[model samples]
Target: MSKLSTYVHVPMENRITVTLLCCASFVCIESLRKNWRPALTHLSNGLRIIESLPMSMLNKLRDTVSIYGSANNTEEELGMDYILRLFATWEVSCALFAENFKPVISVKLYRGRELDDKPLDEFESITQAHRAIVQYTRDIFALVWLFRDHQGDDQFWSQPIPRRQHEILSHRGDCMGGLFERFMAKPQAPPSGTGEHYSLQWLPPTVYPNLIASLGIEGRFKLWAEDPSAAPGRRFSASNRATTSKAAYEMRSAKYPYRSFSMKHNEETRHTYLALLASDGRLMVFENEQPENMSEYTPIDELSICTKPSRGEEVSFKVRFDPNPDPCYNAMQAGVANDSLALVVAGMAAVKIYRSRDVITTSYGVAQTQREFYLALEVGVHRGLVRDVAWAPGNIRGHDIIATACQDGFVRVFRIDTPHSSNEGKSWSTSELPRYENHQVQTCSRAGQLNDKQQHQSGLSASLAKSGSHAERHFSGQLGQVKHACKEIAKLDSHRTPVWRVGFDDDGQILASTGDDGKLVCYRQTPSGDWAKSSELAIVKTRMATP
Candidate 1:
């Protein structure tokens, strides 16, 4: 590395040769005790030299290597490959370890100089997955930085943590029995009482259809064939399911690509509804169960459900269904009907909840009924763009829990509490609203405004009322339409970078988040009703070299 640094002022051809040798040496010394500062310093200098080379010269070199080096596998080709690989590895590592550290070598700098493509293998698949994860983190970090610049402090999180029926999180670590038991092989012993013996054998791998290739991220939805336990060999088969169903074909070939999809099943009606978030900022909902011989179907636009759109033109991030069967009844039973369900959609700096509403109308002496979704609540306490949202599965606790990842460098956990279902007869009247001293008014609501008298009657102090006269705005088109109440119980800022994703354990006991910092953080509620960090795993800032 030191030799490479000294050669930075040498002739261009000599500098390239020396830098290549330095990179090869740096990658070979793959010891944990080795200092990376010198390697990074000299590598940056080497990349600068390469970046300054003329494109025509680089192209001519590439052509020469392609024509003659294919047969000999020359040492020069191998050295160049090592240098480029080291450059990519250090570039991604520096971006993940520090905040806002720009890469020294841009994509255009090495546009046609990347390493040669190799056949798919275990190592190749792992390398691709790692690159995808890094790209996702950088995208989320950029989004968060853009929003946080214009954002101010939020008083909604400043208030004391309110008490709720679901304040305590039950521990589920013991439910897994023992950690080692899961990985150990089972004994070949028969049951004491039952006289039946079962065979345990590995099933053959089943290959699926290939996905369509595209420039941007694209996904396809397909349903696999049912298990064939009684087949000749008792193995699953995809013999007749080589092609997707008609509905799946239409969805895959749609005009807009889908970012995410979710499904909800209704026990009473025995029907399932599929929700899709399009890349173009549209929400489409369709009934998953279709006729066997149906030749035509309704377009997704006509089947699109209602949503509380965001003020900005940002694309929708994620759409999720409340895992609870009756989220509406559990959270806002007082106002919503018994059969309604909750659906969550996250977008730019906001997460909104919609509830199913059935409307019946009679026109020209005919009666018709239609199911539509209406915005029930909107949680905009996040100071940055909302990246992901997760709804915890229903548990013994009476309230519903939601976790959101935001660009504001925090993973926020909120509990949906209703005075009606959680605690009978404990309702929040319109006249007794909580006071917000530092509440921001400009982004609160763009549709409605409250006068002095209304603000005063909302139980705000004189000073608070004066500062917040225009603070009570709704994202659902009009004010006073949303009656659902929710509170942010915990804000986990251990990531200290834009969080990309958040998820809850199966039992909703443990919440985990990950982001640009390359750290996995898990939170559990403490006895004092506050969320505390339970464990953290750091995955960034490490070098992996093959011997």
Candidate 2:
């Protein structure tokens, strides 16, 4: 062969080898990718199947049902309750009250402990055992009973089975009978001295006949049906009204010798009736008559009452009031202001200010225009209280400042001012400054014009300056403390009980508090503006103690 021909042939062979290698690599890559998907999919499916099986099934097959019914009803009348009790009782007697109930398969116990292998023999005959079981079941399933009896043994299974068969048989009938009996009996003794007790029987629904009757008559009342398939029925009048009306009552006994009670009217009732039971058991009824003009009276949806004990079985009344138009007002802190505005913290969203005034009459002059106002604010916190409110210096600018404390331990400041800033510059206009628009200003400066020079002259200037200058100002020149919004700004930690009430002074310098533990704590603002325990005042001790 010639040298040129040999070189040319070698190049051709190299190209063919490179092409073959590429094809083999491509085939291997495709094969691997093809197998990957099925493997991943199979793994995912197996995990899902495993997760779907419940742990309960893995252990044992025990079923539990909760029954509810009237305590007042007889077995026949409480049809379902009666049947469940009967079934449980019958199962227990049949299973446990036998000559060979728990067939002995030898087991060992600790030396100090002793085992009683005595068989139950309470029933005279199988028929009697069945009857006892039925009676017992009726007592436990207090409301109603629902079950399927597959075996025809209901008629004759009461008879004791042959001893030889006991070993091979599943013995479900006997097992069920025994279980029902145990449940019907008192719960295994709870750890000694716990004093906790629970009964299988339930309270009677009939106890609230008045409530049911009210719901039936009032078309608005409806029951909360858990099952959509069940009939949509009207709940007893009381239950429906209780859910929708927003009217409620809470009664607390006044110490050992006194009693106290409070009632709240529902928002639905434009007119409300409140009955206060005093310590001596004397009832005082206050009827808030509906106004001729609905706009004049603020609709009261939620109500609460608080009472304080006085001398000799008489309680001085302190009512925590709320006029809820929305569910937000369901929880509120209430206080009376100088016999005028009834200050209330309604939910976390707003404060409700209510006032009642009498009108003079000429001859048969009928009183008119009992005004009610609701000042809503976005800054309100849930379970927050309008602990204390004060009019700004002079009340000249038609402005009022309010301080609120919340369960979360945050204190919020809200300013109620005339809607028009133009009116603010003018001297206090007594023209009954039309209801002020409640604005939740970011700072006091945004709320109104601040005298910077005067602020600088006074010690208060430092606090106002930290809020920034005019260029950053968004609203009126009012300045607000951002840190004051924290729930713990005015915390009361001295008492172990939850702080129920909180209040702040005009400068936001001092905080007053009361709580379930019946202790009053005073906290003062530190130089840094954080609240600290007041060194000047000793804690005011309350005479009463919580139970």
Candidate 3:
């Protein structure tokens, strides 16, 4: 393979520029071919090729972009300050990646680190245990840099995983390198009372403060999702819509947009979706390009997602599932089935869904038009509004199982399946989907009531022994090609306050949720279809230091 790598040289404190360069440039490596020189690839039309970079170093410049330009813009306080603070630790991440790809340090990078007072340590591990912790520390620290919500929310990067309520870091955040030392039980204790500026986490295992300093082309797109400017503020309301504009609140801008929130794709279908929870109780769906055939789903691409419609019109979906839509609803979570026929929406109201023959797609097994989606099933989970919803992939138990986070501070589970009719996930079980004769929805829980106007048309059916007439049985199946859309599985008083999000991981066996208490609880599915809360992780907020 011809060499396509480039090298970047920066002599001063402009680490951000280095990061920008990292994204825009490629690390130029010498061609391994003995006789042939490889071609250099440029990004867009106006990128001046800085040819004739001294290629004396062999694998020395591997896995990096050689940036050879000067900056034209100045950094601002309100604008770049947030990013500066967040990415303050990113230079370390760059170094790690650089060491992975190329061991030799560049002269410019070496000098800049000495000036910054972040001297380097030998990039070697003492023990496998410390090494594992070091790896996790690197990953989570990077996640904090890219995904944390605000600068002042310092706890995200270093907060302790508190086991007791009293230990919650509600008062002050933890130090960066403190956790690693504690976990590793290093020979010497971390400093006792000094508060000097330190990149504890970024410094350990030999500092590469500017290692792989760029987000790269792919990472540049990833940055769009976590841009600090568009992050949601604390005080949100319906009339006072989220500060994000339609253009700014885009998929490219907000994919995995929230701090520590998980985004899922349909496991079984070619159709892909990214759901964003707007501050004022709204759900936005960004889908990948429509597929060419039933057996094919176009691979989701950053550019291919539909953000604008043909007429340049935008749609704002109502969160009717909010127990009360009168005020601004806190839309929490949304999910789609692998088969692509069912959708589950959860927030500060009843749990709502869009379940139809192809509610999300057209008759041709293509992407569904926005107009085709309507509330097919909406059920009240808690007396207060619901917070999150997660749908498991298809199940052999024959139902669309779902989990919910609620404002009432409960994490509940529900199953939406029809036993009488084949209202199961065989939505497209194979190349040729098998169709089951639509039967009456045998039962709607005694307390659960449908909220959609379409619900009056749809009815729930009872068991064969409890049925009165064919009409009553027919009415229960009114959800248009769906039956038994929701039945309460178990409503655990999971948290004392509101539960923020609930979801089943990819496997569909384990469920997880995060709450206002700043704790993450994972529940596993027993062989008998029962859910038991398993483990918990604390991600608490910084509590003010006591005066």
Candidate 4:
């Protein structure tokens, strides 16, 4: 306390003396000043500081509030708080209004037809019938084109002009005017000899209320009403009588059914279905319902069975398999031959071979023993686990080479050597070796398979040793070192997951691969002499539900 009092007293005395001196000095300075320049300069500096104070304080306040405030809060309680609250409420109300409102409109189709005659209740049915008619007309047009191109016949074309003109006139009358005059036309008697009669006729496009239009004699026909309660028995009889009158008309009603649809040709034991490209370059519709007769081959130019409309049909290419039967999954590999013969690898223990020239027939070439010409290897061990097989593009030493990729992350190439001498009884022999030319092995990592501590410790060492041993044994031996003239030309790591299927283009320039990832990767050999993935195409992913 004593030291603090002494220091405070000295400072107070010094402050008083300094204050008196500063006052005298200020008075002297004022007396000596001829003008007010120094005082004005000091005033200007003070004004500048005052001007900057508000901005500095505002920035500090902003930083302090930001540090303490909730980020989600939109409004601050300084000036204009009420206005901000009002704006926020308005924004919320606008959002609510937008959420609750929905826009809708009734879409109608308007052509040169009367509103009163349009079928309002049977709108859906009328639309479907109209679509079917359009398709049928297009098909007829295509057939006409094909007939002209292939047959070079002008008679079929020249004969139908008058009929087409009559049809066009009828369409104009029905469409432009509300005319039910043709509806009142007299009914003609059924044709002679047959209890029921049918005739092919065309109807003018018109909007008939609750009615389906059918062809009639001299601008006359019956209206099949859309009412379910309106005589179902009559409807069936009328439809049948219309279809059965002529052989061409009856055949037009024959239905073609398929169990499934695929872009490529698919087959089972008794039936085969192919997707035929129509002459007009459109994909014809495939019927999934089973056809009535399996024995009859339906050409791609048949008519509809239910509607009796002429439409393109589908055909099957048949191949026969001989002797005993063996069921195999994903075994057939298509080859380079223009004929659609698929090389089938089958059998449970020892893989047997068969070739199907066509898919429909069960008769095929007899099974060939695989062990006769090649090294005696267990089918299940070496080739039995073969998941995908491919045929090389070019002939290797006058023999075709086949490559098989297995489930155990290995690929092997085999050459099909047909015996040169006619004295040799066997049809074919094989020479196989591991495909190692310019190929790299992607070994499974130890971390991937190790489950226990002991396994983890020994995994790396064991894998390394096994890899080394295999390399020395296979690559160092004389047979292994000898590279066949027909070694694997290219090897690629096509997928991260397992590759399920492989396909080659007609020219063998592009390779397409599919895998568990549900992606189709196309590879092309580049100018740099490396197989590089060119593009990836999207595929529909199929998921199998667990039982």
Using lDDT as the measure, the top candidate is: 1
TM-score of 3: 0.34
- Residue lDDT tens for model 1, 1-547: 5555574686654556676566645644532225666655555565666667666433432221233234445555555655654564565566666455445443433333223222222212323334433333333333334334434545532433311101210111232233223322233222222222111112112212211111125444332233434465333222323243312222453776666666555554544565666655566666633433111233222223224345544554678877765543344335444445567888667787766543333334233333445566779898877888999885457777888999889988888765553444324443222222211122123112323223212212322332232122223434223356688999889989889988888778888999988989999878776678999998564334446
- Count of steric clashes across candidates, in order: 0, 38, 42, 15
Clashes of 4: 15
Q: In model 4, which runs have C-alpha deviations exceeding 4 angstroms?
A: 1-342, 346-352, 355-384, 390-398, 401-405, 409-415, 419-492, 523-547
Against the hidden reference, what TM-scores do the models get? 0.49, 0.25, 0.34, 0.22
lDDT comparison, 1 vs 4, better candidate: 1
Q: Encode model 4's per-residue lDDT on 1-547: one tens digit a residue.
A: 2344345545653333333233333434553463344433332332232233334322222121222234443323232223222222322333333332111100001112112232212212323333333322332332332243535455643666534533553454344222222222313322222222122222112311122323232222232333344486433122323223210111121232221111112222222222221212222222222321112233321111111224543221111111112111111111111112223231111222222221110113211110001111112334323455554453322444444444433434444432223442222222111112211111122222323322232433433433342122221222111111223445555566545555455444566777666778787756754456899988664544546
lDDT of each: 0.51, 0.31, 0.36, 0.30
Candidate numbers sorted by lDDT from highest down: 1, 3, 2, 4
Which segments of model 1 are wrong by more than 4 Å?
1-47, 51-216, 226-250, 289-316, 328-332, 419-482, 538-547
Using TM-score as the measure, what is the rank order of every candidate, best first?
Answer: 1, 3, 2, 4
* Residue-level lDDT tens digits of model 2 in 1-547: 1333345544553432333233333434554456543433332332233234344321111112222222443333243333323323333443343322211110011111112222334443334455444433332222111111323444434544322222222343355567545543534423322222110111123222212101111112122212223355533111222343322222223433212222233433334333333333233334444521111123222222222334543122212232222211111111111112223333222343333221111122212122222222224343533333222222232233444444444444444432333332323333222121211121233212333322222323322332333232112222110111112233335545434555554444566666555656676656764556663324573434436
Q: Cα-based RMSD of the predictions, in order?
A: 22.3, 26.7, 26.1, 35.3
Superposed Cα deviation of residue 250, candidate 3 (Å): 3.7
**lDDT of candidate 4 vs native?**
0.30
